[model samples]
Structures are given as C-alpha cells and as structure tokens.
Target chain A: MNVAVTEPVAAAPVAERNDRELAREELTIARKYIGPFPIVMAAWGLGNLVCWLALWPLVMTGTLSLWIAFPLATLNVALCYLPSHEAQHSNYAKSGEPLRWLNELIGYVSTIPLVLPFKTARITHMDHHTYTNDPERDPDYGVKAANAWQAILTGIRRRQPGQPNAYGKLLREKAEAGDETAKRAMMEGLAQTLSFWAILTALAWSGYAIEAALLWWLPRHIGMSYISLFLSWFPHHPMNEQGRYRNTRHFHYWFGNIVSFGMEHHIIHHLHPGIPLNRNAAAYRELRPILKKRGCRLDGV
Target chain B: MIGKIVQTIGPWGPVLFGIGFLAPLIAQSMEAMEIAAPFGLSFVQTGLLIGTGLGLAAKFRGRWI
Candidate 1:
C-alpha cells in the first residue's frame, strides 16, 4: 500500500521571550525525575559487567550447548543493551551527566554507531514521537533497497501510478530529499557491519579460523542479525487506523520479553516513553482501560 | 549484592518462567508425543517436563515466595 510522502514540517517557533522561561520550567520537571546520575550509572555499569562476565566463560569455552548459547546470548543482549537504550534516554540514571558518559561508553564499545549522546537521542527520539508513523518523515521509516534482480524485474513490470512498490517509493523519496537520519543510520550500520566482520578476520589471522567461523563471528553477524531484524522491525510497521500508532506488539513470554525487554508492549512504550521497562507491566495494566476505550489494543506477540 | 541480584531478576519473573521456560517445554513435549506415540514416555516429554518444572518453580518463587 502506498503511503503519502511526508516532509519534515517546520516546528512551531517558541516565542523568544517565552523560550527561556519554558526551558527553566522543563528543567525543573526533568530534575525531579533525574536523580543522582552517578550512582545509577555506576550501579548499571557494574550490573552490566557482572552479567557479561557471567556469560563469558560459557560463550568463550563453548561449554553451553548451542541452544543454550542462543538463548543466553539473546538474554545477555537484553540485559546489557537495555541499559544502553536507557542511557540513551538519560533515564537509567537520575543524573544527566553520568548517563551521557554511560551512553558514550556503550556507543564506543557497542557494535552500533555512537550516533549521538543521551540528550541528542532524547531530542531526536522526541522528534520521532511528534512525527511518528509518518511514512515519509519518520526517521526510522524506509525499506531495504530492492536487490539488482528485483529492481530490474520491477522496471520490466512498469508499475502503474499508485501501484509502485511501497519500498521503492520510500527509497526514491529518501534519496531525493536526502534524509539526514537515513544517511546517518546507514553510515552507522555500515560501521557496525564492518567492525563485526573485522573480528572474524582477526580470528582467522590468529589461526582459529574454523572456531571463529562457527562461533563468535558467524552466529553474531548472521544469526544475531536475523534475530535482531525480526525483533526490531516487524512490530513497528504501519498498523493504526490513522496509521499513527507505531507497530508495537507485546508478547508475554519469557523468551520474548528477554529478547526485546518487553519491547513488545511497543504501543504502550510509544505512548509513555519515560516509563521504565521494569515498570511497563504495571503501567500497561493501569492504562488498559483507557487504551481499550480509545479502541487501541496490543497486536501479535 | 544478593538483594540486588534478586531485584535484577525480579521484574522479569513472569517472562522467565511462564513464557521462556514453559513454551519451549510444551513444544518439546508435543514433539516427543509424536515420536513416542505408543510408548509410555519419551525423552522429549521428559525434557519438556523437566524444563517447564524448573521454570514453574522459578515463577512460583517470583510471584509468591
């Protein structure tokens, strides 16, 4: 289905006289929720270290069976990565500075690109919120470019107006307008893809070619990529009557929760971005009636 | 530290037990049932029960104890 191409609409300008006043008010509210950033940062970091170290031996030695490895590693990503996500939001720690540091650390160590600090992610994420589900302007919107074969076949088919592929249309608009987020995300994704492949190369250089191919290198890039894609993408596609609700499906299974950190409660998450993951269930329960009244419900797991 | 660890694992209790542990075991049990159609028991069934039982214990601990 073809969705309208949306451009970034100019934000309503804050009156110069009121902008500073509003900033102060927002800061006060932010401070009430943002507690001692250092303690939270230290605690989260320590907890992250413990979890990773706990898994290191099993993963390194290959003592755990492949099935166990799959689940454990996925869990590990949730534990460690959620903290990173929280850090990005500046919510993990009550303090802002420490959260920035934590996010920066993760950005560097994380295979993903360090696109921005907490403040930036928060701002950009908020922008995502305001323009959410907008097929064109939503930063995360875009389909994988069709492969050469598909592109050639599509050309031969000569798709009629309003019948062009959704992905092809999105790509065409993204290229023409040169969306900044799409460019930045592609750069980061490229960097991550290369860094991961480099590890495999290093292992080959170290004479553990076969082991690396089977273990760290292949599973993370190949298997983990597939897992990550499905976990991240499918739930948030076009799904609302207004096509505004970001596709967020919540699954109440342990594996599902661990895989996405209850991200499946995605609709609720989009509605209440500040609610901690740990508190989502309670919040969801409380908000259920209101959501139902609005005719919104969580979709597939 | 122990308290923190418990706290760490607390919020995830339902998921760890109900869905994560139980779902797989149920799947396995079904598979085993198919394999051992005439037998009194099957390895898959045993594995499923063991896995689910452990998960159920964890879940019970999380919710009640």
Candidate 2:
C-alpha cells in the first residue's frame, strides 16, 4: 500500500509563542483594571487636598503639633507621589483622550508638596522604568544602591552646589542633545526649584521661617526619605543591572502593598508597565506562576 | 454582627488608631501653642483611650498590619 507523503506544518518558535501568550494575558488583565484606576486616583488626589486644607489651618493656627503634623504631612506628601506616578504612566487619565490634560494637571498639583516638577519627574521616572538598576542609565541608581541612611545623606549631598549627580547629569545631557521633551522638563524643573526657594525666602523674610522650616521643609525631607527608602532602595537594591525579573523585587506584605499603593509588586510592574496599581495584586497572582518558573526573586515586607 | 463591623472598618482600622494615638501629642503641642483644649477633656488621656480602643478593634479586624 502506497501512502501519500504529507507535509508537516511548522510551529512558531517556543520562546516567541510564549512571549505572545504572555503579552495577550497581560493585556487582558490590564484592560480589566484600567477603568477603575482613574477613579481611585481622583479619590486619593482629592483626599490629599482635603487633608492638606484641614491640616493647613490647624498648622497656621498652631493647633496641629509638629509631632502630629510631621507624620501626617509626611504621609500626605508620600501619598502625593503615587498620583504623580500614575500620571507619569498616563494611567491617571485614559490613553489618547482629551482628559489627559487632567492627568498633567493632577501630576503637577500632586507633586507640588514634594517640590518635584511633574514633567521632569515623569521623564526621569520613565527612564528609571526603562533602564532599571543601570548605574549609568537609571536616574534612581544612586539611591537604590545605597542603604537607607546613605541614600538620605546622598540626597542631601546632591543638593549642594557643584554636585551634579547621575540624574542631573543625564537631565543636562538630554537637554543639550536637543530633546524638546527633556528641554521642557529641565525648564520646568528649574522654574519650580527657583519658585520653591523664593517662597522659602519670602517666608523667612516675613518671619514665618520657623513655621516654614517646621511645617514644610522638615516634612518634605521626611517624605522624600520615606519615598527614597520604599520606592528606590528597597525595591531595586542589591540587584545587579540584569534584565527585568532579576533586577526588581516584589513585596508580599499587605502594609507595604497598601502604603505603596501596590507598588510593592515592582517586578510585576517592570514586567508589565501597562498594568494599573489597583490591579497589581491580581496581576501578581496571575503572573506568579510565570514569575516562579522564570526564577524571579521576591523581597521586602 | 461583630464580623460585619470588622469587615466594615477594613484597613482603615489601623489608620484610625494611628490618628488617635497621635492626638495626645497633638494636644500637648496645641497647649504649648496656647490653643484652648476642646471640650475640657484631657486630650492625651482621651486620645490614648480612643487609640487603644481602635487598636483593639483593629486587632480583632485582623487588618492591623
């Protein structure tokens, strides 16, 4: 019996097929959670404003104590970073929509307490996500590589004159390279920095220096330090400039997850930047098997 | 009913406790600033008691972390 020879169909490469599957799964999961994120952002953003308004009168009237105000203000300021982070990802407003103006507005307002220019921060943070753990490329490397104390000290040191660090240098280089986005970011950053100093000077000139120092400056430092530790040092430290999974760590503890607004899932974030913060836990669960199979490291509380 | 109450407060339990715990120090600071203490109650003692109560509730709620 003569059997006709049949041609075997060729299958796609295993790695390519797996990557496509992973992308599809991530997209589906991300789409499910993206709608609610803007609402959460608005709630938290407005909450921060309300807290500031309530506390500001008390602060001005000397009703709110430094001990209380410090922690509360610090927490508020730290929380502000989250909305700005969401805006940075264009997740605060829907993508390709007119409401994107709201995202930029929210980003700028949210970062005001921290004295961070939204444009500059957004660009630098995007770079951080793109080049995580890269000593040369990541704007966050100096802070991430240092211990908490060192990170704090380095932050102080970097603020001094003639002490341009990696981030600043990169910003300057990008501006010099005729990058319009970077140029606008640098201009905004400088303008915001100057405005902050001008306000502080005016405060001192008007004899509210003590109040400014106690209520504003101190809390900003505390908030900055808190963010430095949680976002930079804890998530990326002790990891080399390896590819995504190997370089970032995930936190399983609820406290960390809540306070960080689900940012504790840094590895998942790096692996899937499209996922919103509110759904990070769900995404983590969905991707946990894949992550484990890929041997990703888990860290932090 | 108790489980429902615990479920209702959710993660806010610790946050409320934390606020209550800070109230005493806040009261003292207000006193130093010559702000009149509200309601004639000892803010510190009151804050501590409220904090402890919330802390207990939080502990019961199992969301204190």
Candidate 3:
C-alpha cells in the first residue's frame, strides 16, 4: 500500500460569518456520501472466511500444497476484521431494525477464524471510538508503541498469560462491577478462546499440527498484527491528541489501502461512524477540504 | 481428582504448544532439510521429546521466553 504522509499544514481559521454556512454545507456533503449499504464489505467478509475454511480441506485432502495455502490463509485472517468492524458500528442496520440480524450474523460469523467474540469486539470498539487515544480507557491503547515491530510485539505480549491486555482487563473490571454487557463479553470471549485452543490442540494431536498452525494459530498472530498496526496504531499514532478529527490521521500506508483494509480513510470513519467502509475513500475525497479547514490531522491523503 | 491432575500439570499450555505446535513444525522443517534425529529416532519423535521437556520446564517455572 502507498503509505504517504507529509507534515500537516496548519489549518486556516473559519471566519465566524461563513462558519455556519460552511458547516451546514459540509454536513450536507457528508450525509450524501453515507452512501449505500456495504454489500461489497459483506461479501468480502463472508467470502474470505469461506476461502480460509476451504484451505483446510484442500490441504488435508492433498488438493493444495501447504506452501501455497499458508499465504492464502494468512490473507483470509487479515481480511477477517473489517466486516465485523462494520457490524460494531451497526453500519449495516441499526438496533431494532429487521436486517439487524444480518448485521449480527456477519459480525459473529466473520471473525470466527480470528476467534474474536462479536460482543467483546463491539463493546471494546465502541470504547475505542469514544476514547480513541485515552491511555487508561481506550481498549486499543495497548497497541500504542514506538514503531511497527513494537506494535506487533505489543499485540503478541498482550495475549501472553500474565501480560496485560487492555480489552480483557477492561472487560474483567466491568464484569466484576456487575455490568451485564461486560459479563456477556467475558463469556463469549472465554468460549471463543477455549474453542480456538481446543480445536488447534485436537488438530495438532491428530497429526495435522502443521496445518493447524499455518491455517489458524500463526495466521491469527499475523492478522492481529496487521489489524492492530493499521486499524489502531497507524491511524492514531502519537495517539495523545483528543477531539473528533485530531485523534486520527489520514495517511497512505506503504503497503497501500487494500493491505491496510482501507484504513487510510480512517479519519472519516472516526468522524462519521455511520459511513460504510467502502464509501470512506469517496467521502474523504469530498470532505478533505472541510477537514483541512477545521485543522484535522490530514497529514496525507 | 481432575483439579489435582490439572495442578500437577501446572501449565499445560507450553507443553501442548511445544508438542502440538512447536514440535511438529520443527520436525517438518528438519525432515525437509534431510536431517534426522540422533539414535535413529524419527524427527517428530525427537521434537516431541524436546518440546515436552521444554514445555514442562516452562510450565513449572512460568513464562516461555
């Protein structure tokens, strides 16, 4: 991806006279680009998962070589998080809506390969949105680090038995305080984690150890690194700034937007969680000028 | 009884990780390199022995690196 960033130009002040008119215009433009239902994201989420599932059978049955399947599986795991992210925002359908079930279905089913619990992901992501760069409260704060390797290492360290994981720690504290939603998140997280290990252990013991490792375990670590790097760390790097636009930046990743799962337009998502993932780029294209005028951290486009 | 066994095992994670994850992977790579374990032991058998030993060490001692 083409990760690009230059020094952000200091924003020009909005004149009081034109501020209201400009703000109204910007709001109208943004709403127009909320765009259509994320059909593409839904397909990407489901199809990537199916393709990952198919890899296991193909490798086991000798239809495909492990050498090739490993990369494909890694790609699948990396692709796993975005659709569910859409679900986290309730971008597909709002609460009490009929298609909410579809939103929930995609949310729950899409992340199975990564073994992330839907409710857990949802609650923590909402926290992330609410407290994007808060060191103490943001569930993603653990991903903050000096560089990419540190970010990846931080992701790994958090999963180690005794190491502190921000989301897990937050959920545990909330559950202890008798928060019902936190309690559900804890249960789902535990079940998913156990299932992941149990299945991996069973497969390994049955002599598919290499397959299990490549298909799920290692891929999970790699995918988490990718997700954490692009989704959390990169967008919100030097993550101390507060407020709507300052907390996230628009930068082109060296690997390009696709590899980063279109997070290059992440600033837009933070500003309007309702904008579907596919529409962020187009929205950002239109909204960039307004963002610049407001002194958003639009370092790169 | 189950708790006793679980306690006795201390941490089963490293042990399982060693045998289930580390061992087989190492064995596969070793075999690919045309290397063989000493005493005519199969590569996987050697890996299991080593992985279990290390896993148990980490289990009791806490931490894997």
Considering only chain B, report the TM-score of each candidate against the true chain B.
Answer: 0.40, 0.40, 0.72
Better of 1 and 2 by TM-score: 2
Judge candidate 3 against the unseen true structure and give its global Cα lDDT, from 0 to 1.
0.81
Worst 10 residues of 2 chain A by lDDT: A1-10
Please give me the total number of clashing residue pairs in predicted model 2: 0
| Isolated chain A TM-score, each model | 0.54, 0.84, 0.91
Name the better of 2 and 3 by lDDT.
3
**In model 1, how large is the Cα lDDT of residue A136?**
56
Give the native contact fraction of candidate 1: 0.00
Query: Individual DockQ of the candidates?
Result: 0.01, 0.02, 0.35
Per residue, candidate 2 scores C-alpha lDDT tens digits across A1-301 of 0222243322443244465454454455555554554677767876795786577668778788756876787777777787788888887666678787888788888877789888888889988888888778888877754465777776665543334556656777898898898877877876786577667646543445445555566678778877877777767767485786688878655465776656677676677665666667887886675576566787655
Among all windows of 10 consecutive residues in model 3 chain A, the one with the lowest summed lDDT is: A1-10
Query: Model 1 in CAPRI terms: which quality?
Result: incorrect
lDDT of 3 by residue, A1-301 (tens): 0122233323454444256555665666677766578898889888988999999999999999998999899889989999999999887888998889989999999999889999999989999889989888888888888887888887777766445567877887888898999988877887787778778877876778778888888888888888888898889987889888699999988878877788899998998888888999998998887888778887752
Estimate, for each residue in A96-209, the C-alpha lDDT of model 1 and write its tens digit: 554555655653343221212332334345545566545655443332223323432333233222234333333345545877654444345444544554554454434334
TM-score per candidate: 0.47, 0.71, 0.87
Give the distance in Å from residue A164's predicted Cα in candidate 1 to where it truly belongs: 17
